[model samples]
Target: MTLTSQLTVGVAAFDRYLAICHPHKYALVITRSTSNIMCILPWILPTYVILGPMLGWRNWYPGIPCSFDIIFPKSLRATAYIIVYIVSIITAILYLPVLKTAWRYYQRMNKYQQNQTRDHMQTTNKMKKAILGAKVTGIVTIAFSIFWLPYMTLSSWIMVSPTAKSKLESDLANWLVFFGASNSIVNPIIYAWKRPDVNQQFKKVFCGSKPVSHVEHIKT
Candidate 1:
């Protein structure tokens, strides 16, 4: 929940980067109304995709999956689980490429190999908050893979299987779920502590001062 909201906020920051920091193309490509629509997509899509679907799907299937209503009948919850799992799988596929590309950019930048001039290096440094961003993203994916993915898969099997899960196994999962949900809060905290520029920009952007404009890429 918080993770979705924060990602939406992060996208807003990205839009600001493109508009203020990359004004040349931004000027050519986006009018204020179009920019407004672009900015809304992150928040709007999730609301429609994740939240809306879940709520609406509950009418068809009387239970919510892996959520508070998991205590409902097996048949009801099973359908809900399938719905949620499909959505989660789609989420993973979309983000996997994003994460891979960010990692490559991070490695290339840190290696000092991206056709850098002095001014170019400075601009890249400022714009690429993505190393830390990628870390956060990777961590979320890992958590999803570990905590949710297998559970969803197994539960699908459980939907059919007569063999019941032992108390120890279910207990362990219940205990670990909090750690999985911690990803959202953890990302900001880790970035703030480890990345000085991100911390500064974060304070500048949200703490009353005008945020620094997104920097243009420098020509060599």
Candidate 2:
């Protein structure tokens, strides 16, 4: 799940990067097959590299039950470390470019506005979409990092701790897990909120009628 979340958000960030930094090439670079493959890697790595070995070695370890919960202590510790660091690194790599791209685009747009550049309306519209994509990417990146970092940190600590976790610690861990899980639920809401067209279509489907005219369309 950690890998999947990071991968998905990373792709979203890359999409923003292409839209901002290489607008003309964005459509060509992010084709349907490319996106599908990016989506598939998270599932593939977890299944083959993580779970596959666990399944194969399930019988080798006798005392620890052959279940997902019954991981070897060392393996759990390593997994904990992997999740924490890998996610953080991948997120940084993904978002840093996005931040740079957004900043550069913003500066260009400001300069254009001040200079009264040609094709003002068209340029502004494109800038708005690029900026909007950057904002959405930023939201997803922040949400995932904030939600998962604490949980992963606490989980790693727990995995390495010699003593058992107290009731408070256990409760806190459980709550953090829920907080991490909530990001999945929150992401779709964020996307729909950012894109008015999506929200309007969603409303129409449920209402079985056209959306109200007063609903403000997102400029992007």
Candidate 3:
């Protein structure tokens, strides 16, 4: 589930990159079918990693039920972490151009704001929203990195340095695992904090607010 979440976030970042960097081609490239495929691919790609032990690609540790430590070899586990880091790097790369473009748009909007017509105002409003959305996504990405990096680094260390494994390290790894899992809990809060629509729906569902009609909008 964590792997799927990370990959889905990466896909979302990529989607925003396209929307901000290549607005003209984004509509044609990111259709309904394309969106479906993007959604499915994240889940599908992680399945193999999750199911590798059951599929006999790796052996589980004896007397330790379903532990990640011995499920895959040290080399394979290290490789998986490398893949995850690559995804993180790529997500960061995609955001750079988006931030640049958003800043440029903001400057242009501000320059014309005093004499702006209705159409320009609307465009400025959209640019503001887009900038907010990008910041929200960036926050989520940073949160993922904060929560997962310690666990990944520790786990990789344990795998690579078998002699360094000790009760202290094991306990630390366990705590870090929980810390990483907390990202799942943090994500919805992040979304609600930055997104008014999501915040409103959260209130309506959890706080017994009245139903409000809203058109669904994807930030990116």
Q: Pick the candidate with the highest lDDT.
A: 3
lDDT of 2 at 25: 96
Worst 10 residues of 3 by lDDT: 211-220
As a TM-score, model 3 comes out at: 0.85
Angstrom error at residue 86, model 2 = 2.5
| Clash counts for the predictions, in order | 1, 0, 0
lDDT of 1 by residue, 1-220 (tens): 4334344444433444343345467566677887787667556644654564366554445454454334345765565565555545555555655556555666877798657899877656544653444444445445445644554554565557777766665665555545556555665675565545565587787896655443332111
1-220 per-residue lDDT for model 3 (tens digits): 6577778889989888877788788889999999999989888856877787778866655776675666767776776688788889999999989988988886876687689888866655666666666788899999999999899888877777749689899889989989999999999999877787787777889998964543244343
Best by TM-score: 3
Could you tell me the TM-score of candidate 1? 0.45
lDDT for model 1: 0.53
Q: Is candidate 1 or candidate 3 better by TM-score?
A: 3
lDDT of each: 0.53, 0.72, 0.80
Residue 46 in model 1: shift from native, Å?
8.6
What is model 1's C-alpha RMSD? 7.8
Candidate 3 wrongly placed segments (more than 4 Å): 54-66, 162-164, 203-220
TM-score of each: 0.45, 0.73, 0.85
How displaced is residue 152 in candidate 1, in Å?
3.8
